[model samples]
Every structure is written in C-alpha cells, then in structure tokens.
Target: MEALTLYQLNRRIAELVTNSSTQNVWVTAELSDVAVRGGHCYMELLQKDPDTGATVAKARAAIWANVFSRLRSDFYIATGQDFATGLKVMVRASVSMHPVYGMSLVINAVNPEYTMGDLLRRRKEMLARLKAEGILDMNRSLCWNEPPLRIAIVSAEGAAGYGDFMNQLNGNQLGLRFTTRLFPAIMQGERTAQSV
Candidate 1:
C-alpha cells in the first residue's frame, strides 16, 4: 500500500464530493445562531433528540452577506416571523467541505414556508405531550400584544432577519414608538439553547 500525501487526500475527497451528484436540497432545522464577520454570515443549524434533548446532528453553514441581506429582506416580507435564535428555518444549500472546516453547507436560498412547517410540527408535538401530561393549559396565557415599549431583543447583529424585524417596526404607520435593546444569541446548534 502507498501512503497518500495531504494534497492527494484533499484532492481525492473533493473529487468524490463534486462528482457524486448535483442536488438542490431544502433542509429544515432550528437556527441556533448567526454571526457576520469578514463579509460572510456564519450560521449553525441543528436538530436534537425529541425525548432526551440531545443533539442528533449539526452542520456549519454560511451565506455571503450580499445574499444574506437580500434573503433576509425577502423572508420577512414573505413571513412575519423574525429570523432569530429559536426560530426554525429551511435552507436550500449545496453540500461542500473545506480542508480546515471539514464540512459545511453553503446556503444558496431559503424557504420560509418550509421552515414554518417544521416549527408547526414541533409545536404540535409539544402540545400533544402537554396534553398527555394534563398540563396543556396550565399556565395563564400571557399576552405579548403590548410588548414593553423598551425591549431587549436577542438576535444576530447585522443579520438580515434582524434588520427586517427592525425595519418593519420602525416603519409602522402608527408611529409606534419603542426603544430596542439588541442582545446577540447563537441561532443554531446544541449551544443555541444556552446562548438564548
């Protein structure tokens, strides 16, 4: 057997990934966090064991700021949900890997509807579990209709999703006034729960 050089190993892996198939896939997951640095937005997406609450799988993902900015605007216009930590999202991505990063998904597009479906599914599951435990309506319903005029919102700094949220609120015709405090949170991955 012959020893494979580092260059040879990388080339082989790249070729295998590139040649296997070309697919445009839509993936659904929870957005754990988003960060912007060096003209790119880095994201972490994850899923966990429903019963044990342990992470099952995770991926590092990214969007160039230009694409992210446009998507962020379009997403908000299409859906009222703010793209933030704890919100579910569906992304159309390309499978890719870097020598240093190992594996990542380069998000080319997003489908808010798909993400919403995932959220609804999770919501239903939680509702069912609560019903089984006879605690579905245990807590008094809290109305967030009149959110504190001074708000501490947790979101990704400079993220298009966050930007959209702010823009909508700021542009309200009623001149609704509020002071916003921004707190950063990881929007995806196992650590997302803790970050929030």
Candidate 2:
C-alpha cells in the first residue's frame, strides 16, 4: 500500500472535481446560512428529509462579487425578498475543491422563480392544512356585534398606514365615537413574525 500526504490527497480531489462533469450544473437547494462580505455572497446549501425534517445533504457555496452584485438585486426584484437563511434557491454553479477549503460550489447565476414558486407552494400547503383543520374560515364564520366600536390596531408606530387608518376613523362623516388602541408591532422583515 502507498501512503500520500494530506495535501497530495486534497490536490488529487481538487483535480477530480475540476475535471468532473458537474461543472456548470443546476442545483435546487435550501440556504441554511447566507452572508455577504467584501461584496461576495457566501452560503451554506442543504437538503432535508421531507418526512423527518432532518438535513440530508449540505454544501458550501459562494457567488463572487461581480456576479453577486447583479444577481442579488435581480433576485430581490423578482422575489420581493433578499437572499436570506432558509430560502430555497435554484442556482447554476460549478463544483470546485481546494486544498485548504475542501469543496464548494461557485454560483454564477440564480433562478428567483424557483424561490417564489416554493413560497407559493408552501402557502398553499399551509392553507390546505388550515382548511383541513376547519380553521381556515374561522374568521369569516365569526359574527360581529353592533358593528364593533372598539378597534384594536396592530401596526408599527409612526407608520404611514397607521396614520391613514387613524385619520379615516377619526374623520368619519357619521360623527360616531370609537375607542382605538395601538398595539405597536413590526410589520416586516425577519423578526416580524415574533414581534407581531
């Protein structure tokens, strides 16, 4: 048996990866982590087992500054969202291996439609589940008493919408008095769910 140093083995792997047919392949993966540094986007891509919800495959990936600058804005324009953790993305990438960094994918392009489609699918699934549980129409089924004099507003303070709502309610032509309370809440971004 012959022995090889760690660098020699890594070099061989790098060569194999570079020459492989996987170059310029399209892959669908979930972004477990995303970051931008020095204008380059770095990400960790993964796949999970549908039934168990456990990660089954994972890889490191990156988009160089030149490509990332355009792709980032394009993706945001198409998807109405930024590249963030937990987003499923379809990307065109080349598999690369380095002696020090092991393996990573060099992404050159991204398909924003893939993420949008996935979001729609997930929303549909959630709605279906709520329907099955008989909660989907719960709000519609509720009966209002006396046209609801008390308004509980959930919105961020100083928001334009909040001001508009208050103005509309206060300027009502009927001159009816109503009690209103503002419950400040975050309306968008990552912490919105928890904050709201």
Candidate 3:
C-alpha cells in the first residue's frame, strides 16, 4: 500500500467538502454573545420551537475580521440596534468545515431589516404567550427611578450600541456626572454565553 502525500490529502478533503453539498439558505436566528478573536468573530445562531419554547437547532459561525468589520458597521447603520446579543439576524452563509474546528458557517452577508423584523415578531409572540399566562404585567406593575451617578455597563468594547448608550448616558444635556465601567463580553456566538 502507498501512503498519501500531504498535498494529496488536502486536495481530497477539499474536493469532498466542495462536492458534498451546496446550498443557498436564509436562516433566521437569535444573536446571542458575539466575540472577536484572532481576527475572526465567532457566534452562535439559534432558533426555538414557537409553541414549546425549546431550541430547535443551533450552529457555530464565523466572520473573518475584514468581513466582520464592514458587516458590523453596515448592520448598525441600517438598524438602530447593534448586531450584538438579543438581536435577531438573517444570514446568507456557506456551510464549511475546518480541519480542526469541525463544522462552521462562513457568513457572507446579512439582512438587518429581516433580522429586526424577526426579532419583533418573536418578541410579540413571547409577549402574547406571557399575557395569556398572566405574567406579562408582572414587571410593569413596579416602577423605579433610573440609576444616578456611576454606571457599570457590560458590553462589547467597540460595539456600536455600547458607544451610543454611553453617549446618551454622558451627554451634556443630562448634566449628570457619572463614571462608566464596561465589562466586555464575547457578545455573539456560543462563547457569548460562556463569557456572561
């Protein structure tokens, strides 16, 4: 028997993956924690069963730094909400596998509007369900003043929402002096939960 050369092994792997399957899919999922590491941003995209409130499926995805930076800015400008935790997103991605990382999705682009719409729909559904269960008004029955003075905010370091939140909190109009402590989190994918 003859041993395969490194180049031959790599070529075979590439061919196998490329020809195994090809699909252009639109997936709607909740964006949890997002983290950028080593020039790559990793995140988890998940969806839950509407009636049961149980997760249906989840996947690991990544955006290379170049793509992430542009997409991040575009998403924020298009939608008031930052592309961070608690945001819903619709992604056009390719299914890929890494030699070491196993299965992953390489996100090509995003539809912020679609994501926002999905989020709103999900929120409405959740609210309706809670209302029917007699728990929707539980928190609304209580009221409290906004915090004064120091604010400890936890968010991604350069996330657009974080910046906006800080700006509003420190703007001169408020005339309220305060210090901000930002505890950065992974913000998007599977690591997001772990960081929190």
The predicted structure with the larger TM-score, 2 or 3, is 2
- Candidate 3 lDDT over 18-71, as tens digits, reads 543534466678765566888777888778776995778888888889898888
Which residue runs does candidate 2 get wrong by more than 4 Å? 134-196
- Candidate 2 backbone overlaps, count: 0
lDDT for 90 (candidate 3): 89
Identify the runs in model 3 with alpha carbons over 4 angstroms from their true place: 1-17, 20-24, 122-162, 174-196
Indicate the residue-level lDDT of 185 in model 2: 82
lDDT (C-alpha) at residue 69 in model 3: 84
The model with the greatest lDDT is 2
> Could you tell me how far off, in angstroms, the CA of residue 79 lies in candidate 2 after the best superposition?
1.1
Candidate 2 lDDT (Cα, 0 to 1): 0.86
TM-scores, all candidates, are: 0.61, 0.68, 0.62
| Residue-level lDDT tens digits of model 1 in 65-133 | 878888877887776554565567888887786665566788879998886676689779989999999
As a TM-score, model 1 comes out at: 0.61
**Candidate-wise lDDT, in order:** 0.75, 0.86, 0.75
lDDT at position 130, candidate 1: 95
Model 3 residue 164 distance off true place after TM-score fit, in angstroms: 2.9
Residues 84-111, candidate 2: write the lDDT tens digits. 7677889999998888889999999999
